[model samples]
Target: MKKKHVLRLLAAAVTMGMLAGTASCGNANQKTAQENPLAEEADSAQTEQEHESAEEVDMVFRGGTVITMLSEDDTDNTAVAVKDGEIVYVGDEEGIETYISDATEVIELDGQTLMPGFIDGHIHEPGNMMTEKKELILPEGQADLDVYKKELQSFIDANPDLPIYKASGMDLQAFPDNIADNEWMDELDTDKPVVIADVSSHGNLANKIALEMAGVTKESTPPDGGKIFFDEEGELTGYLSDAVSLLSTLPIIEYTEEDFSSAMKEFQELANSYGLTAIDSGGTIYETEDPNQYEVLSNMHSAGDLTLRINTTSWAGQPLEGKESDRLIKLLDDSQKYTSDFLQICQVKFSLDGVPEGATSALLEPYTKEAGQEEGYAGTQKATEEDLTAFVTAMNAAGYSVETHAMGDASVQRSMNAFEAASEANGGTPDGVINKIAHVNLLTTEDMTRMADEGVIAAMQPLWFYYDPFFSAQEESNLGKERFEQEYHIRDMIDEGIIITGSNDYPVTADFAPLHAIEAGATQQSPYEGEDDDPAYIRNPEQSATVYEMLQMYTVNAAYGAHMDDIVGTVEEGKKADFVILGDNPLTCDVKAISDITVEYTISDGRIVYQK
Candidate 1:
């Protein structure tokens, strides 16, 4: 987009953001305010009465930066007053002393920055678990199979009882045939099975023993959208593509509920430590004899232990019970019809393609020497137009919002067509309802124009630019000059009046840092200074945004993406009090240092679930 256009559009976006806004819940069967005085009034007089009889407030966060992540006007102050579990007020230290009677547990945070909790838009907690579980080993920086062999030898020496030695996170481009060819698995101990999962999660390499355990052989036929690598001599090269292929066959290390709960607890704590009060877990709800992680989250909601506000996605076009169409109807019927603000299901997530690393991202053109496909086919398409159109038509009939994973232009094109079909099915324009295209990487100008005209939300992840090596590769080879400029053209998307929000897509990039994501979005540069030092292939950066625009991605605009604009994402009156206390005001700090922000307190649904 043009610089003048960028500034003008941001001006409008900022103005629109000011008008949009997050926290609270009553206990089930709890008496109403008419019967209970504390519930009846939350005024200064009630504070005085409570002070007279009260020992002190439950918790007091004293003297630290408090970034509400709301207005340019909200204070980054000395302290915050919290009572019963909710933040009563946020202001100066001396002003909050009245609530600091005897029972107040005052915490002194020495100069730590506290902002609103981070929101990881697209993460796989289960996938994250795979790292620790199955003992998956990742490559040390610039290191190769020798590193893997050494780590594995040590692991086997330490714990021979662990059945399988499954590892993940290997890089193909980094390894050459001389050092470690595709068939390097033969060097490993065949008796003690091992499988190496690629960092991309798109492929894996397995030893002979592991292959036998997975019941695959050299003669095994590859599934549609999946491949097994073979050497020039027609030998098994130990490589396997497509996650569903590997995960379905890979050996597992089972965990008890306690173990799973422990991991989740740590995950939750980490989120709070980083100032993530609420998250759209980005998984959907549809139940059966067979249930996924979303079902576990639902149970947590039922037990009132779902501490974070998670809005999940329903699997659209993924068969549940009868047909994809039926699932969409059920999801719509139960969408807004569920109680409990802690857990919600409103959006539907559809996977369209694989990652860029494996050249399986459904790009407009194929990579240099990809194994399969017509000489120039980029990647496999997930659904035929008929299937896609039918699904979108059914979704529209059910009046449900859909979130499709559109990475490449071709997949993006299919998503647009489906959106058009869904829109046509609707018979008229549907306003305030934002249907998002998640992880829209490498979108062309045509993609953004269509999104704007069709009102399709571009829920993009800035982290991808930093994670994938393609930014450099594409600049040199694939994109050529003209199309290369269109890569991750976020500034243009915003200028076109398409609502853009940031996502982490965690467990993919290990980039669950929301502030860092914002910094990347605002600066359109990597968080680290030296990230751009290289002369040969600098990551193409986008236009810089004012601090206001960054905040909206997580706030106002985020709420809009989740279809919860009326409820949260800001601190307006009547909006849920889901705000964070930062160590310094982001506005006052240098833009370069915003990513270093710390969180002293995190409030969700007006409850103080975490405090430093």
Candidate 2:
């Protein structure tokens, strides 16, 4: 017998408890048919008629666990049928046979688990492509400054003909005061401009030549929501915070349409391998100056080349004042031409504050003494609350959702306030609008309730729940032990009825695996080997969520956040046939082993996109 057939028989036997009492089973079967002979005959006739009337499907999957993601209690589903890119039937193995025919392609799960294809609630899509094409991406987790210098010099030497040099992924913790200066980078190259972006992408360190090229000097004023650092002697230190406007002046690589198309295709395949069929491009749409970026995506979608559904956004620029807000609305309106089933541009993104690692995130209280701040020093906000409210109101009224980058408690509160004011202004959040606050690293209990009441979604990165080696110390110093420990109240927020979604914030987070995120969120500890053994690696255990909850964050909640809930997120009839078949059931496995689960197959639009 085939292995699949044997496994099916065994599964059936176990389900029916065939070994418990054969005589009892025979007695029950005999009683059922004999006691109600006419009823049993009617049931058989109904079954035959139903089978004859069943519509044939294109694909059928059985002999495995099916997670519908419809509810926490939905756990018994084991089969699915699909036709014309939509799920036709979702039920038990016997029910799936109704839709099967000789021509139907049957996929034997072989005791695996099938669930909705993961959705990244927040990620930078083409931004990674642009970085790969324009800059030298440094190795992640390199804490040595000398290594960066060496790598930068080597990259410059190899690409001598380039007009300028650019590198990213500099660990801020490796620098003095978590800030870089021009001296060492200037030592690498003096003739050509060189700009190095910190790992967080919230800060940048430019060499003397790059600073000069950008016309930045000691007297130059930084743009709103940005900071240009100076030394004790009042010399430009080449450190910039949230200052992309000035950096754009430097010459960089220009990628063509074909380049972007190729990069997107590669990214799609990579995402599919990770069981991702959809992603919300969180504000990286304007990262590059390429005007044809959206066009490239639209072209691909029109040509049926896109394997991933993308919810794209436009970057709501800094100083989101009245005029700027109006400009953003008009930009989004103009972008409506690109809207399609595979590509959507109905969201706008803006940062309300910087990150805590840089001691720039706006906080409600003062930073600790170790953070190098004055006794009562708090952080700063990008725009005034009035401006933020106005911007949010404009976006909401224009029939779009706003996604804010809010890290500190103050920022989160201000974002909520703005969202609330926007709702009031727009008469209840506009229909179908789902405002989001991303990177809600610090939030108060009151605000959690407020977020739930106001229907605001939290776009969170689960990987940040753990006390990872990179930013833990900085965050602790910046927020103090009490506040730091209170951060990332994922479970609390979820319990308060606030919808939370998961994301890796790709490019920002190099490791973009949902399984890794699921494990980290569940354990609230570092997923890295030998790291979780240290107690410090664990964050607030109470805030840790279950593996199934993390899955919901990546699937159903994310689909709602992206406004794709109507067609995806759950494995149900009439929904898109997007699913990932895993080697093991994450819900039933040991929490620590969740990350080790392999994606055996990824199906999108009723087509097998990946198999392993």
Candidate 3:
């Protein structure tokens, strides 16, 4: 982005000092009786009634630097009033007091920084947390492969009464040699089937018995989007990939309704602790054709166990086995029965490609050392362009938004092409529709222009902007210098007018703190500053955004991406009372310490959900 525009935005924030309320809902500035004289009488009567019943208000928060996120007109030293489950007032302290009474539960923030509740724009709470709760989860990074085997053995022994053994979160990269075959796991537990999944959740390591349980043999044919690996002797190595891994685990692992509910509760608590009022389940359904997770979320909402607002997309292609479009529409339509202020089913999700590490993400150019490919191997496209375009067009015609996982430049380009086709077929994005492309890890200049022109939301993970020591070298080699520098070109998107939003694809990155993402985004470096201070660690320094810009990505922009901007993005009157209080102002804090600043309180639906 331009330095001039950056300074102007910062200047606007500085000018907002101790100002008061703006207009409610859409308008930025409050309209006076002189401006709208026709409603003067009703406004006066409503104000009088509000004052008469001030004591009935639910909660009042004061003595804080409130970042209303009201464009460039937000202010500090403001107080907010909540009644029922909505915000009634966001103004100066004295102005807020008029709506407060003895019955109001008042919270004195003492100069804390208050802003809209954070939103994890792209997360997979259902399958990830459900699996974590039901199965054993090994740590993310383990230098010793034996540690995982020992833990698996201990877990199996401890749960001797149990029927099956399942675990996830193993680092395959760290111990590739050990997982070359199932011999190590077979030595541990040959009788009881044992299945341990890699951290990516796309592959699994199983013992001989587990393979048999899943009905996999040397001659077994892998399903669509799946892979079954074998040794040189044509013997099953018990390594399953992609859709096959998901299908194989179903035989040994069980996800009961109660297990799903418990997992949702666990995930909600974690999100609440991080001050997340809402999260987008980037993809919905278990594998495909199974809305078990959705049913659990619905039941939880009905039982009032749901605390975070959830917006999810229907999964496409996989596990469907050629039945994609029609079933997807039915699932989207059925989800409306469970829709509410806290839960929504909005988008149809498609995976144009996979991740770069797996050499599955479709790329315009070839990878330097892509596995199972010739010298000039570009990646693979999971779906034909015609099929993808048709799906997008069909979903758009049905009035449901679309979002695709596009990691490689080729996938990103094709995804844009699909959205463009949808827009043209539907005569442009209809009202209340916003298409999105998740994980835009690589984007060309033409792709950027098309994204901005079509208003495609860039749902990005700022935490992924930095160079990961484990894979940066490989990534660099795969894309050479010209393309390497363009990796995660966030500022380019911003400059091009793309509505970029933030997320922390939870299981992929252990923590889902928006503050950590903001700090990482600003510096384009490690959140832990001292640990990796090398200049080479910076991915694209010039592309780093200001802290203020990062905050918008977390709040308003994120809400916009989730189709919740009209309700919860900004601290506006008539919006939901979802906001968080921080110990320090991130806008003015030492950039490195932004992550260190704690969430002092998290208020959701006019009630305190978390406090520290």
Candidate with the greatest TM-score versus the true structure: 2
| lDDT values for all models | 0.57, 0.76, 0.70
Candidate 1 Cα lDDT to native: 0.57
Error of 2 at 338 (Å): 2.8
Off by over 4 Å in 2: 1-51, 232-234, 285-291
Give the per-residue lDDT of model 2 (tens digit) for 210-324: 8877888777876655677777677788888777678787886766778778888888888999899999878652345323667888899888888888888778777678887
Model 3 vs. true fold: TM:
0.86
Could you tell which candidate, 2 or 3, scores higher by lDDT? 2
Per lDDT, the best of the predicted structures is 2
TM-score of each: 0.77, 0.89, 0.86
Better of 1 and 3 by lDDT: 3
Task: Work out candidate 2's RMSD over C-alphas.
Answer: 10.6
Per-candidate alpha-carbon RMSD to the true structure: 7.2, 10.6, 6.5
Clashing pairs for predicted structure model 2, backbone only? none
Residue runs of model 3 more than 4 Å from their true location after superposition? 1-56, 126-128, 161-164, 176-183, 208-250, 284-292, 319-322, 370-372, 477-482, 529-536
User: What is candidate 1's lDDT per residue for 1-612, written digit by digit as tens?
Assistant: 000000000111233533332111111122211234554467977755754564455666666766555566666576666555445655666656776867677777566544444454555553454346547556434346677777766766666777777665565544653112345555655367776666555567777777777777777866544566666666766677653454356555665554555555566666766667566544521122113344566666676565566656666533212377675566445444343556555456777765554455677766544233347757776666677777766665555567777666778888888888778877743443457777776677777788878867767665544322332442224434454445566666777777666566555555466776666666655565555333432344555556666677666566556555455564432345566777666767877687777665776665666776
lDDT of 3: 0.70
Query: Of models 2 and 3, which has the larger TM-score?
Result: 2
